[model samples]
Target chain A: MPKIATREAYGKALVALGEENPDVVVLDADLAKSTKTIEFKKRFPHRFFDLGVAEANMIGTAAGLATAGKIPFCSTFAVFATGRCYDQIRQSVAYPGLPVTIAASHAGITVGEDGASHQAVEDMALMRVLPNMTVFVPADAVETAGAVRAAAEAGGPVYIRLGRSGVPVLHGDDFEFVPGRAVEMRRGLDATIIACGLMVAQALEAVEQLAAEGIEVGVLNVHTLKPLDVQAIVDAAQRTGAIVTAEEHSIIGGLGSAVAETLAEHYPVPMLRVGLRDVFGESGRPDELLQKYGLTADAIVDAVQSLL
Target chain B: MDTEGVVAELAEKARVIRRHIIEMLGEAGSGHPGGSLSAADIVTALYFKEMRLDPTRPDWPDRDRFVLSKGHAAPVLYAALAERGYFPTEELATLRKLGSRLQGHPDMKKLPGVEISTGSLGQGLSVANGMALAARLDGRDYRVYALLGDGEIQEGQVWEAAMAAAYYALENLAVFIDYNGLQIDGPVNEVLAPEPVPEKWRAFGWHVVEIDGHDFRQILAALAEGRHTRGQPTAIVARTVKGKGVSFMENRVDWHGVAPKGDQIVQALKELA
Candidate 1:
């Protein structure tokens, strides 16, 4: 499978959106090159604003531009995009329900070697709790392109989480991404693995491996965290009887907690969460950190096995 | 109107705005009165004389923008909006009430004529910068104005925005610092002195202007200077008295966020009348 970083896809999509919509503008906090928004800057210099290393200002400015009928895409590292400017996002963007897209890059432990400070393992939790925010964690480059387009077309505040490292493309060119709808990668009966972001790819691999062992498990890609497809989760739970959630984020408030909340209220099923165990990420290679934090395909397999 | 007539009309409007602020705060029983009262003249000048706005067309793209960065003074903004006919003046008493468009803080979505929702200090200037940038991008000549509190500048984000505004050379942006000297804790000088405020803005590459905030002529002149200035943004440091027009509350720290009670309200209205 071809590989491309989600941030790269985001950059390409932004350039295309700028061509289609003259009102589209981009803002970055001195990380345009890292976040891949420099591409949009190159294409639309007049519409791109490098706000220096100020994330809070970038967010508030984006809200202001939205008020002026400009669709602004504010990009920065997820750590700074969500945590550093959470109050600004809540007050300026979400409170007004502005049509601004917060395209946060380098999300989760994939931002390796930069240590805990750079890795935004709890970004989804910070954004999802807001009143009028739509959170998207695309599975790969293809889905990231679709997610960015969706956010640009959908008015109101949308947060698209992108990874720093390249992941295998799991969707084809014809794949269509519908917000709040989960895509079932594979079907089975024994257990279901619900995941988002980079974990969806790992869950797909785990499903293949589990199938080799005569264990039939399903993989459900929950790309949109907020406005989660509770109906899909319920259908998967009814078909598989057990549930396991996987993500490259904290177990407390990412995919696991969202799925658990859905099932606990509607279906009351046994489950296991596979991700960071309420601990911070450390300096290491992306693969090493994934293994150390039990975020590999084998971890998903183990989680499914534990639930069964 | 002639200059004298304009100043007289604006002065009367400022008085009426102050009356509205006091009555609304008294009805709500809690709000930032000192800052609201202090900002009356500046806001009144903008809404009534300076800003090009149509109350019926609140979403006019080319209209000048005003952001109340010191958003706790929402009573002043709401009063000005009502007096400008953005909404019914009767709605002024619904401040801070359940389902009232007039929230304790300004909510742009809930109220008309509110360019940006601001309650958290130090965030509005950045929003104003964005609006100015948008105007430039769209090739429109609309100007953006932001009002910041003296103590609110203590937030590091304000400096970040200050630096960016100068870097962008936003000639269309004008910021006003209501230097009333008192904050919720105490005197801003005693709490955390942001002394030499004008020099700080000048060092940040802005055209600094100092004026008496209550003087309508000075306020109008400074705004005109800001408009004519080129290459960089302008910062107008308006030295104002906290709780202006109300003798019992003027410059007194206790009235910073307190609503005036029965006798106090009577005295405040009497002084304004």
Candidate 2:
């Protein structure tokens, strides 16, 4: 079986969308090669814009294009897209409710050799808080492609978080992606391990390990963080006595925070969050950082065991 | 458009806009007056005489668009919008109050005529550029306009947008600079000078125009020149005086954001009358 990264899916989807919609435009802030928007640029030179290290202007221009009824997909490293140009997104895109799809690539520790500075773990949190903003984190390449299509079709602001490192193609190519729905990957009764992005693979591995120990650990892939499926989380919490949420972000405000917020209001249960704990990531290898930062399969299994 | 009669009408509108700014600031007790008063005539000319905007249909697709890049001076734009019938003129007194759409800065979601929410300086031009590019891609004939403050131009992103607009030869886009010389800290010469603004814009490949921003005839004439220019974007460097109408606040840094007291408001309105 072949494996691919989520960022590649973004590039593929951009080409596909560009072929279909003439109003679709691609913008890059000097990372066309890295973010994989180069494919679309090559195919449709007129529709592609290389913004040259101006992320703020890139986002604002995307908003502007949307105002003129054009769907603009802006691609860049997640750090610059979310952290550096946050205000531009807030005022220009989100506030006006423009249909701008921000395809943020190289998210989280999975970005590997670029180290902590390039990896964007806090994007989910930052994008989630903005008014009228939609957040989606795909589990694999197939799902990322589907999310890009969904964002393009959806008439509003959407943020698609993608990764640089290659991972298993768990979902088949024919799998249909929904914007605000969680996909139940495994069935169990003991505990539910909700995960997103690359963490889904770790979570599945944890479930397989826990099954050997006679623990029926369930796994759920929560791709959409905003407009979250509150009922699915409540039902999962009801079916399983405890829940373990894992993500590549700070525990203070991100995927874990969104899950916690929903469960607190609707359904209360014992929960354990496995992610960064009020500390900045340091320069290290991808796998080393995952282990050191407590984002591995072992960490997920431990969190589930602790919750039980 | 013949600019002679239009200039006189816009000049009178600019006077009323200035009066509106002072009165509203007095009611609010705190608001930017310097930049707002400086930009009154330029914005008034765009809204009343230059742009093809329908006050009734604030979201008309074919209508020309304007983005106030320097948004702290929203009072001027708001005054112009009210005068143009985007909203009621009497509601101007409710500026910056709780539950009012008239926020301290422009909020596009809350206000109908505001194109983009701006306050954090140096981002609006990029947004206007986006709109301009969108118009071209969509094959729409409507042009886009943006106004910038002298002090706000100090932000590097403004230059980034400047370079991009000229690089694209966005002939449908026009930018204005309210060269009032005064910012919050002090005179721009004392704080951070943006001298030879027209030369800088020309160097960036834009069709630069130097005009007396307060002279409504000159402002309209420059705008007319921008319309016929075919190859590049136009930047009108409108030299203006901060707090152009009010006697005490003119050229004074202290009046940058401070509203006048009740007695002062009476005197200011009297001057306008």
Candidate 3:
């Protein structure tokens, strides 16, 4: 399979959107190179604004642009993009329900070496709790591109979380992404593995590993965290009889908590959450951090085995 | 209207807005009264004399934008919007009530004339910069105005926005700082001084103007200067009394966010009349 970073896909998708829509403007808070919004800046110099290292100002400016009929895509690292500017997002963007796409790159523990300060483990929970916000955690490069395009078309506040590290491309060119819908990657009746972001690829590998041992594990990619595919999760839980959730984020408020809340409300199912258990990340390689945080194929398999 | 005529009309309008602010705050029995009264003249001048707006067409693309960055002054903005016929003036009584369009803070979605929802300090200037940039991008000449409290600029985000406005050279944007010098805690100087405010804005590459915030002529002249400025944004530092018009409430820190009670409301209305 081809390999690409979700941030790279986001950059390409933004350039494409800018070309198609003259109203599409891009803003970055001094992280254009890292966030991959330098691509959009290079293409449309006039429409791109580099707002220095000020996330709150960037979000407020994006809301103002939205009010003036311009669709703004504001980019920065996830930690600064959501946490640093949360009040600005709530009061300016979400309060008015502006069509500002917050393209937050380097989300989750996958943002390695920079340590916990840079990694945004709670971004999903923070954005999910906002009244008018739609949170998207795309599985791979293809889905990231689809998510960017979808956010541009969807005239409201959307937060598209992108990764810093490159992962294997899991979707084909014809892959369609529907917001609030889950895609089942593998079929099984014994147990279901619900995941998002880098964990989707890891869950696929875990499913294959579990299959070789006469265990049939289902894999479901929950790309959209808010407006989550509740029906799909409930159906998967009903058929599989057990559930496991995996992500490159914290177990407290990321994919695991979202899936658990859905199942607990709709159908009570025995479950195990595979991710960091209320701990911050540390300086290490991307793969090392994933392994240390218990966010790998082996961890997902262990979670499934424990549930079974 | 002639210059004197415009000034007098605006002054009377400011009085009406001040009366409404007192009446509405007393009705709600809760709200920030000091900031609302202090901002009355500036907001009145903008909505009644300066801004090119049609109450019937609130979504006019070319309409000048006003963002109340010091959003606790929603009573003032709501009063001005109602007086301008944006909504029924009777709705002024519904502020902070359940399901009222007049939220405790200005809500752009709830009120048609509100350009941007702002209650959080230090965020509106950045929003104004975006609107100015959008005007430039869309090839329109609409101007953007933002009102900020003096103490509100203490938030680090305000400086971030101030820096960006100068960097962008947003000649079409104007910002007003209601330098009433009192916050809820105490005097803004004793609390956290944002003094040398004019120099700070000038250092940030803005055309700095200082004036009496309650003087309609000065307010109108400064706004005109801001409109004519080129290559950089303008910051108008308007020195104002915390609670203007009501003699006992004026400059009184206790009245900052407190609603006037029965005797206080009667005295305030009498003073305004």
- Backbone clashes under 3 angstroms, per model: 0, 0, 0
lDDT winner between 1 and 3, please give it. 1
lDDT per residue (tens digit) for residues B1-273 in model 1: 799999999999999999999999999999999999999999999999889899999999889999999999999999999989999999999999999999999999889999999898899998998899999988999999999999999999899899999999999999999999999899999999999999999999999999999999999999999999999999999999999999989999999989998988898999989
lDDT of 1 at A270: 91
Q: A204 in model 1: Cα distance from truth in Å? A: 1.0
Candidate 2 chain A least-lDDT 10 residues = A278-287
| Model 2 pairs in collision | none
C-alpha lDDT of residue A196 in model 1: 93
Q: Residues A175-249, candidate 3, lDDT per residue (tens digit)?
A: 999988899999888999999998999999999999999999999999999888999999999999999999887
As a TM-score, model 2 comes out at 0.96
Model-by-model DockQ, in order: 0.89, 0.71, 0.91
Query: If ranked by lDDT, best first, what sequence of candidates would result?
Result: 1, 3, 2
User: After best superposition, candidate 3 residue A119: deviation in angstroms?
Assistant: 1.4
Q: Per-residue lDDT tens digits of candidate 2, residues B1-273?
A: 465676677778888988999889999999998889889889998998889999889889988999998999989989998999999999899899999889999988788888888898999899899989888877889999999999999998899889899888899999999999988888888898888788999999999899999887788789999999997999999999998888887888898889988888998888777
TM-score of each: 0.99, 0.96, 0.99
Colliding pairs, model 1:
none
Task: Score candidate 2 by DockQ.
Answer: 0.71
